[model samples]
Target: MILEHRTYTFKPGTVDKWMKKYEAEGLPIQKRHLNRFVGLYVSEIGVLHTTVLMWAYDSLADREARRQAMYADPDWQSFIAEIWALDAILQQDVMIMNPAPYSPPV
Candidate 1:
Protein backbone atom coordinates (compact mmCIF):
# COMPACT_ATOMS: atom_id res chain seq x y z
CA MET A 1 0.00 0.00 0.00
CA ILE A 2 1.06 3.59 -0.65
CA LEU A 3 -0.06 7.15 -0.02
CA GLU A 4 -0.86 9.81 -2.57
CA HIS A 5 -0.13 13.27 -1.23
CA ARG A 6 -1.96 16.12 -2.86
CA THR A 7 -0.97 19.59 -1.83
CA TYR A 8 -3.53 22.24 -2.48
CA THR A 9 -2.81 25.90 -1.94
CA PHE A 10 -6.28 27.12 -1.27
CA LYS A 11 -7.30 30.73 -1.58
CA PRO A 12 -7.73 32.57 1.68
CA GLY A 13 -10.76 31.46 3.72
CA THR A 14 -11.52 28.67 1.30
CA VAL A 15 -10.57 25.81 3.57
CA ASP A 16 -13.83 25.66 5.47
CA LYS A 17 -15.81 26.14 2.32
CA TRP A 18 -13.91 23.50 0.40
CA MET A 19 -13.95 21.09 3.31
CA LYS A 20 -17.66 21.36 3.78
CA LYS A 21 -18.42 21.02 0.10
CA TYR A 22 -15.97 18.19 -0.27
CA GLU A 23 -17.41 16.22 2.60
CA ALA A 24 -20.96 16.97 1.64
CA GLU A 25 -20.72 16.16 -2.05
CA GLY A 26 -17.41 14.70 -3.15
CA LEU A 27 -16.59 12.42 -0.26
CA PRO A 28 -19.68 10.30 -0.45
CA ILE A 29 -18.93 9.30 -4.02
CA GLN A 30 -15.31 8.52 -3.27
CA LYS A 31 -15.93 6.71 -0.01
CA ARG A 32 -18.96 4.68 -0.97
CA HIS A 33 -18.15 3.86 -4.57
CA LEU A 34 -14.43 4.15 -5.10
CA ASN A 35 -12.99 3.69 -1.60
CA ARG A 36 -10.57 6.29 -2.83
CA PHE A 37 -9.48 8.00 0.35
CA VAL A 38 -7.61 6.71 3.34
CA GLY A 39 -6.61 9.89 5.12
CA LEU A 40 -6.67 13.65 4.72
CA TYR A 41 -4.66 16.19 6.71
CA VAL A 42 -3.99 19.88 6.85
CA SER A 43 -0.80 21.54 8.01
CA GLU A 44 -1.07 23.08 11.47
CA ILE A 45 2.50 24.43 11.20
CA GLY A 46 4.36 24.17 7.96
CA VAL A 47 5.67 26.10 4.99
CA LEU A 48 2.77 24.96 2.87
CA HIS A 49 -0.81 25.15 4.05
CA THR A 50 -1.27 21.94 2.18
CA THR A 51 -3.79 19.16 2.29
CA VAL A 52 -2.32 15.64 2.18
CA LEU A 53 -4.25 12.62 1.01
CA MET A 54 -3.25 9.08 1.83
CA TRP A 55 -4.51 6.13 -0.15
CA ALA A 56 -3.87 2.44 0.36
CA TYR A 57 -3.98 -0.40 -2.11
CA ASP A 58 -2.61 -3.90 -2.53
CA SER A 59 0.19 -2.86 -4.86
CA LEU A 60 1.56 -0.06 -6.96
CA ALA A 61 -0.14 -1.31 -10.10
CA ASP A 62 -3.42 -1.53 -8.23
CA ARG A 63 -3.02 2.01 -7.02
CA GLU A 64 -2.18 3.32 -10.47
CA ALA A 65 -5.04 1.51 -12.10
CA ARG A 66 -7.56 2.74 -9.59
CA ARG A 67 -6.44 6.34 -9.74
CA GLN A 68 -6.27 6.24 -13.51
CA ALA A 69 -9.77 4.94 -13.65
CA MET A 70 -10.95 7.72 -11.40
CA TYR A 71 -9.17 10.26 -13.50
CA ALA A 72 -10.82 8.97 -16.62
CA ASP A 73 -14.30 8.67 -15.20
CA PRO A 74 -16.61 11.62 -15.81
CA ASP A 75 -17.96 11.87 -12.30
CA TRP A 76 -14.54 11.84 -10.73
CA GLN A 77 -13.30 14.38 -13.23
CA SER A 78 -16.14 16.77 -12.44
CA PHE A 79 -15.62 16.35 -8.73
CA ILE A 80 -11.92 17.05 -9.13
CA ALA A 81 -12.68 20.15 -11.15
CA GLU A 82 -14.90 21.42 -8.36
CA ILE A 83 -12.15 20.82 -5.86
CA TRP A 84 -9.64 22.53 -8.08
CA ALA A 85 -11.83 25.60 -8.26
CA LEU A 86 -11.13 26.11 -4.57
CA ASP A 87 -7.37 26.13 -4.88
CA ALA A 88 -5.00 28.82 -5.99
CA ILE A 89 -2.53 26.18 -7.04
CA LEU A 90 -2.42 22.45 -6.58
CA GLN A 91 0.38 19.91 -6.72
CA GLN A 92 0.52 16.19 -6.25
CA ASP A 93 3.35 13.98 -5.07
CA VAL A 94 3.02 10.27 -4.62
CA MET A 95 5.03 8.21 -2.18
CA ILE A 96 5.30 4.45 -2.07
CA MET A 97 5.76 3.12 1.46
CA ASN A 98 6.25 -0.02 3.43
CA PRO A 99 3.88 0.42 6.36
CA ALA A 100 3.10 -3.10 7.48
CA PRO A 101 5.89 -3.14 10.03
CA TYR A 102 4.59 -0.20 12.04
CA SER A 103 0.89 -0.57 11.47
CA PRO A 104 -2.18 -1.77 13.39
CA PRO A 105 -1.84 0.32 16.53
CA VAL A 106 1.28 -0.78 18.31
Candidate 2:
Protein backbone atom coordinates (compact mmCIF):
# COMPACT_ATOMS: atom_id res chain seq x y z
CA MET A 1 0.00 0.00 0.00
CA ILE A 2 1.03 3.61 -0.52
CA LEU A 3 0.53 6.43 1.90
CA GLU A 4 0.30 10.09 0.94
CA HIS A 5 1.38 12.42 3.69
CA ARG A 6 0.50 16.07 3.33
CA THR A 7 1.72 18.71 5.69
CA TYR A 8 0.43 22.24 5.55
CA THR A 9 2.00 24.97 7.61
CA PHE A 10 -0.38 27.81 8.21
CA LYS A 11 0.52 31.39 9.01
CA PRO A 12 0.99 31.78 12.77
CA GLY A 13 -2.52 32.33 14.09
CA THR A 14 -4.46 31.30 11.05
CA VAL A 15 -4.54 27.57 11.67
CA ASP A 16 -7.85 27.69 13.45
CA LYS A 17 -9.41 29.79 10.72
CA TRP A 18 -8.14 27.47 8.04
CA MET A 19 -9.29 24.39 9.92
CA LYS A 20 -12.75 25.85 10.38
CA LYS A 21 -13.07 26.56 6.67
CA TYR A 22 -11.76 23.17 5.73
CA GLU A 23 -14.03 21.28 8.05
CA ALA A 24 -17.07 23.21 6.91
CA GLU A 25 -16.42 23.11 3.18
CA GLY A 26 -13.35 21.27 1.94
CA LEU A 27 -13.79 18.14 4.04
CA PRO A 28 -17.07 17.13 2.49
CA ILE A 29 -15.87 17.64 -1.06
CA GLN A 30 -12.62 15.79 -0.41
CA LYS A 31 -14.43 12.93 1.30
CA ARG A 32 -16.69 12.51 -1.68
CA HIS A 33 -13.75 11.89 -3.97
CA LEU A 34 -11.09 10.24 -1.84
CA ASN A 35 -12.13 7.01 -0.21
CA ARG A 36 -9.01 5.89 1.61
CA PHE A 37 -8.99 8.75 4.09
CA VAL A 38 -6.77 7.92 7.00
CA GLY A 39 -6.48 10.81 9.44
CA LEU A 40 -5.85 14.49 10.02
CA TYR A 41 -3.55 15.85 12.69
CA VAL A 42 -1.98 18.98 14.07
CA SER A 43 1.54 19.34 15.42
CA GLU A 44 1.77 19.61 19.16
CA ILE A 45 5.42 20.41 19.74
CA GLY A 46 7.98 20.40 16.95
CA VAL A 47 6.14 22.33 14.28
CA LEU A 48 3.52 24.72 15.52
CA HIS A 49 0.63 25.79 13.28
CA THR A 50 1.01 22.83 11.01
CA THR A 51 -1.56 20.26 9.97
CA VAL A 52 -0.82 16.77 8.74
CA LEU A 53 -3.12 14.69 6.60
CA MET A 54 -2.68 11.02 5.79
CA TRP A 55 -4.27 9.02 3.04
CA ALA A 56 -3.78 5.45 1.89
CA TYR A 57 -4.03 4.31 -1.70
CA ASP A 58 -3.52 1.03 -3.45
CA SER A 59 -0.97 2.57 -5.83
CA LEU A 60 0.34 5.83 -7.28
CA ALA A 61 -2.08 5.48 -10.17
CA ASP A 62 -5.01 5.19 -7.80
CA ARG A 63 -3.93 8.28 -5.90
CA GLU A 64 -3.53 10.25 -9.10
CA ALA A 65 -6.89 9.19 -10.45
CA ARG A 66 -8.70 10.02 -7.23
CA ARG A 67 -7.00 13.39 -6.83
CA GLN A 68 -7.62 14.27 -10.42
CA ALA A 69 -11.29 13.62 -9.99
CA MET A 70 -11.36 15.79 -6.87
CA TYR A 71 -9.61 18.60 -8.69
CA ALA A 72 -12.13 18.40 -11.50
CA ASP A 73 -15.10 18.79 -9.23
CA PRO A 74 -16.65 22.25 -9.23
CA ASP A 75 -17.13 22.24 -5.49
CA TRP A 76 -13.48 21.42 -4.98
CA GLN A 77 -12.45 24.09 -7.43
CA SER A 78 -14.51 26.65 -5.56
CA PHE A 79 -13.04 25.57 -2.27
CA ILE A 80 -9.53 25.94 -3.65
CA ALA A 81 -10.37 29.46 -4.72
CA GLU A 82 -11.60 30.30 -1.25
CA ILE A 83 -8.50 28.82 0.35
CA TRP A 84 -6.26 30.84 -1.92
CA ALA A 85 -8.18 33.96 -1.11
CA LEU A 86 -7.78 33.25 2.59
CA ASP A 87 -4.01 33.20 2.13
CA ALA A 88 -3.47 31.38 5.39
CA ILE A 89 -1.01 28.69 4.39
CA LEU A 90 2.68 29.40 4.54
CA GLN A 91 4.04 26.18 3.10
CA GLN A 92 3.07 22.70 2.04
CA ASP A 93 5.02 19.46 2.00
CA VAL A 94 3.91 16.24 0.41
CA MET A 95 5.46 12.82 0.65
CA ILE A 96 4.63 9.50 -0.90
CA MET A 97 5.50 6.63 1.41
CA ASN A 98 5.81 2.92 0.97
CA PRO A 99 5.15 0.57 3.85
CA ALA A 100 8.07 -1.40 5.24
CA PRO A 101 7.94 -5.11 4.44
CA TYR A 102 7.42 -6.00 8.10
CA SER A 103 4.88 -3.29 8.81
CA PRO A 104 1.29 -4.11 9.43
CA PRO A 105 -1.38 -3.03 6.93
CA VAL A 106 -2.73 0.48 7.49
> By TM-score, who's the top model here?
2
RMSD of each: 3.0, 0.9
How good is model 2 by TM-score?
0.95
Q: lDDT values of the candidates?
A: 0.66, 0.92
TM-score of each predicted structure versus truth:
0.71, 0.95
Error of 2 at 70 (Å): 0.6
Candidate 1 local distance difference test against the native: 0.66
Q: Which whole-number lDDT from 0 to 100 does residue 41 have in model 1?
A: 84
In the predicted model 2, the residue pairs found to clash are none
Report the poorest 10 consecutive residues by lDDT, candidate 1.
28-37
Q: Write the per-residue lDDT of candidate 2 for residues 1-106, one digit (tens) a residue.
A: 8999999999999999999998999998998888678988999999899999998899999889999999999999999999999999999999999999998888
Pairing residues by index, what is the TM-score of model 1?
A: 0.71
